[model samples]
Target: MDSNGVDEQEMKLVQGAAGYVLEDVPHLSDYILDLPTYPNPLQSNPAYSVVRQYFVDEDDTVPQKIVVHKDSPRGTHFRRAGPRQKVYFKPADVRACIVTCGGLCPGLNTVIREIVCGLHYMYGVTEVLGVNCGFSGFYSKNTVTLTPKDVSDIHKRGGTMLGTSRGGHDTSKIVDNIQDREINQVYIIGGDGTQKGASAIYKEIRRRGLKVAVAGIPKTIDNDIPVIDKSFGFDTAVEEAQRAINAAHVEATSVENGIGLVKLMGRYSGFIAMYATLASRDVDCCLIPESPFYLEGKGGLYEFIAKRLRENGHMVIVVAEGAGQDLVAESIEQQDASGNKLLKDVGLWMSLKIKEHFAKQRKMDITLKYIGTFCPLPNFNSSYLRFLKYECDWVHVSDPTYMIRAIPANASDNVYSTLLAQSAVHGAMAGYTGFISGLVNGRHTYIPFNRITEKQNKVVITDRMWARMLSSTNQPSFMNPPNGATEGAN
Candidate 1:
């Protein structure tokens, strides 16, 4: 404590800039002394000559938190990502390689394309290699030279043009290969675990006194990687889920006392499930990893389903794959190659539970009957087939094998991936190492690798965004008793 007991630490002032701290990224100059710089190609390129603001000032930064109080310190900031006036590596000296690790995401191809194009078009760098099948490819010699023409139409396709894998990170071998191939700039695209691997590679490179610049393009369809606003391909995953949600809605409404149960990919964070449920107004209940839900108790999912179905003819239930793990009985513990927990099929379990509960209770006597619209076919006799009334007390909708992460990036994700890729390319060219190209508070910035991979970001069940989603779905938070509304539910 200071003498005055003013608690100056609460102010959290930065050096020379009161209350503002720059979370600066590592540069080659930080480790390698007297690193020479070359003029940025954009300075003389006719394509960018007419643009007024072609270069980003070194002093420019973006705040991590935008909703701070008036009296609060400005909090932390990161260097804004873009082209700089001078770059550490010359065009002819740049030997870059791109690798995608972990699982497949929507915009992997888009990111690969932009990174190659950004280097080829923005700078005159010629040598770019695609490390196939992830980190293992580093030693496996599964590489192909990448050019703008090679990735020209790959963006229009689904999945990565360069294949990806999980848990092949051999730091010694990878760095050895990098040194062997004279690769100076490395672009790694992956999720939290993958970024951790990227961090390891960077540390090894730094330890060996190598001049390679390692840049990370964070990739997680789950949106669990912290510090970034949102990862690329998350939008496309959520959008692709709309089709499944719509299909469930149709099936549920079609059957008597129907319960369309859908499961989405969310092993840790519930962003995909939450947003999909919110977008799907048909959902009557949302279950996620962040929100603990019961099934057999007073405030259980069964009670909510009974109530919702009683009020409405049918109900749709959206659950993240990681939800209800505590309730599901799994005797064996398993982990994937990337060390992520293997989640059981919560959607199937939920469907079975709902069916058993309803069948045992025998409380519902649904005789759903609907008439099809009569229409006259061109050059054919008018005919209409009416759906017969069915008496199924309970039904379910499930297709757990359909995964959304492998699909092509939607328009929103494509643009976001392009920006992220360009930002990574820029940071690499500018000599930033051991950093992630991510969006913080809507502004793209360079984040240290450890800051991104140290922990996973999760959904805040108590936050207002969750409340908004709850309000949209009209679903119970599954937090309160059946006789009362959920506590603190918005």
Candidate 2:
């Protein structure tokens, strides 16, 4: 205590601390009351009066600011949503735009409908435009004005009405288009690359002293976006993948000692393959990019498949495209339009190797039937197996790639996509920018776009989920042993 019986540090203001200057934040009473109101009776609900809190910190001392610096030992850097009841722009004056980029996922149309409906019915924003062909539409003058009525039935559809593409990372052009249209908010729907572009666009808007709010809905069939618990369409993808696995199972069992090798769509992570295998429980062996597998060792995949075939007379293998990239002789570093690495045809390689192994070893006169390649390999059939019930050898390969990605969202995904779109619209209207609406631990939340694009959400091999998958398939756990050893050794 000081000599005057008071501490001097208590009187001085602590800037950027938790709960500092929160009273200075503008309130709904200051501006929202002056703006025009909507005719919707949903606004009369008692819950409308209760504003939802954004920051998880219960400390009342934190300030209400767009960005806060947390240099203290106990504080964390966080982005918080503004008061739900108030928004930065007036409803009638706001011009909102929606765009979809990156590859297609199941619930893209559903999200578009939800955003348009939310803006029209809840917020009374009448002017909404849709940008076509991804970010290129901004510069290319390809936009269509949208309405709630126009998007009413979009949720029942599959792909995005706005259409989508991969590249077009020019932030300046996008901002120029936004400013020309006097856009107040932007909703970007796609995966990590799309959100990263959104972040850049928002930064450019801020640099130009504009008040446009940018929001994103996380979309990736691969489910590889960082920090998100789940992405839209993943459930539907898994469900569709089950059908493909069943087909492979039927094909494998139809012939004697047949092996079914099914390749699912997953470039970086094996979430789709892993989840599909888990859901179906029909795959005898599941390989993902996260878990590498050897081909010729005693405990490797070759022996594993042979053992499964010997015991059950039929075997099914589920492999993500990215699982055995390292096994290929050449580099598969080429990326597609969305910057995804072109997989080195691990499925084809595995099928050929399995056939070669069985042929060279001649352990048994097994026939292999490979399907789903762009073209069948050059007339590589065996004479001994020609007279069998099936003309081919031990295995059949199929890739359920586009079939899964193009389907509509399932019941769970529809709910998830609706809430995600609603949350995205709420964030955009509340003046929250540079964030993606994401499900964090099953809670509807907005995560920073930069963080979402920071890293990929890969399956942790040490987690219990991996253990469950291993137990389900009974595949070899460690593909690469300790030390500097490589995979695919005899």
Candidate 3:
């Protein structure tokens, strides 16, 4: 006999004699009739009850024919996903070129090296060329192809190994040369002026329907390239300035007699001067291009230094190379041999004014010390002076009189340069045309092609808010006073 409740696959029964049949039973949801009706065993106990049924039928069985619905969570209609695919270039097919124009920065070589290696090894790019003398090299057929081995040892080098030129780009000739040599791409490395040239070249290339890609790499110590965090060489320059200021501080302290005037490089922006002062913490007064001063004003640097000399006996001043000294010296302007007003050196002028004021008011002969040239590299015809021998009565310091044009760049700067180089390679491989590889938020990013337009090349000046913050009287409590004295104390 077979029980009708049993599934067909499991139906089976065994029968036995004597007019009685024993049948195999299927599992049932409830067996209440099998339990004692009154006073059922374990029913009185609250913990256990054989009469109570907890199991129920669930419709979870596998279907005979599975149907995958598109809207279900496990649907098969979702789009395929994978890692991002990068565009690559064949080594033989890529004929890339780079040019460096204008003043040299500390990390120009590092950017060049990374670009060359990234192209050749990672992107299968070959025929990397170096354009000598900037845009001029691109106009003629004098470009030099750089091999993987050419840039192997340039990781720690300072300036661009390919050389640099100030010549402007000749677009028609450049396009002609690119077409003639079958160059696929070009990278221009430089500051504002170089970017302007790059824009022209890109426009010309686009006009002719050339298949060449163009990219720019920002390399300026000024750190003035807008829309980017910072330029490559700025860190190295700031480090150099900090070291110089530290040395000046030590010399200034030991002598206890003379004022040292250190002039820093910042034709427009005072970022270098401000950062260097923050690093050294020994700068007494800093004159930046953003802030102009009058010699006889209430909060003038001259007056502040005079007051300091009367009390502290010596001072240290940091002046940007581009600060307006003419306005400061308007009261007593003098001319040189060529009939040009021999504008007093801001350092010397301030030093002289302080000395005169102290001698007249306090009746003391205060010694004056002037130490200029805050740039890492030597400037043209600038004489060096020893701190103890030339400026002070003490004589234990090193002979700072010798000029040093080249110094080892900072480690931080080298790291930044490497990043910038890698970024340039990435940008070029991605077919990013007419963009500069820049470092921002600690990552390598691009400054778009349009930001370097001719009209946007001007440097931004410090607004009233910045001027107030940097002002001696209105400075924040955390900022050290210009006299190297703590605020709210004496």
The local lDDT score (0 to 100) that residue 410 gets in candidate 3 is 64
Instruction: Give per-residue CA lDDT, model 1, range 215-237, as digits (tens).
Output: 99999999999998999988888
Reference-based TM-score of each model:
0.89, 0.81, 0.66
The lDDT per prediction is 0.80, 0.73, 0.56
Worst 10 residues of 2 by lDDT: 23-32
TM-score of the candidate numbered 2? 0.81
User: What is the number of backbone collisions in each predicted candidate, taken in the order shown?
Assistant: 0, 12, 2
| Candidates' RMSD to native | 9.4, 8.5, 25.9
Arranged by lDDT, best first: 1, 2, 3
User: What's model 2's overall lDDT?
Assistant: 0.73
lDDT of 3 at 217: 82
Question: Per-residue error at 52 for model 1, in Å?
Answer: 0.4
**lDDT head-to-head 1 vs 3, winner:** 1
Better of 2 and 3 by lDDT: 2
Model 2, runs deviating above 4 Å: 1-42, 45-83, 367-398, 480-490
Clashes of 2: 12
TM-score result, candidate 1: 0.89
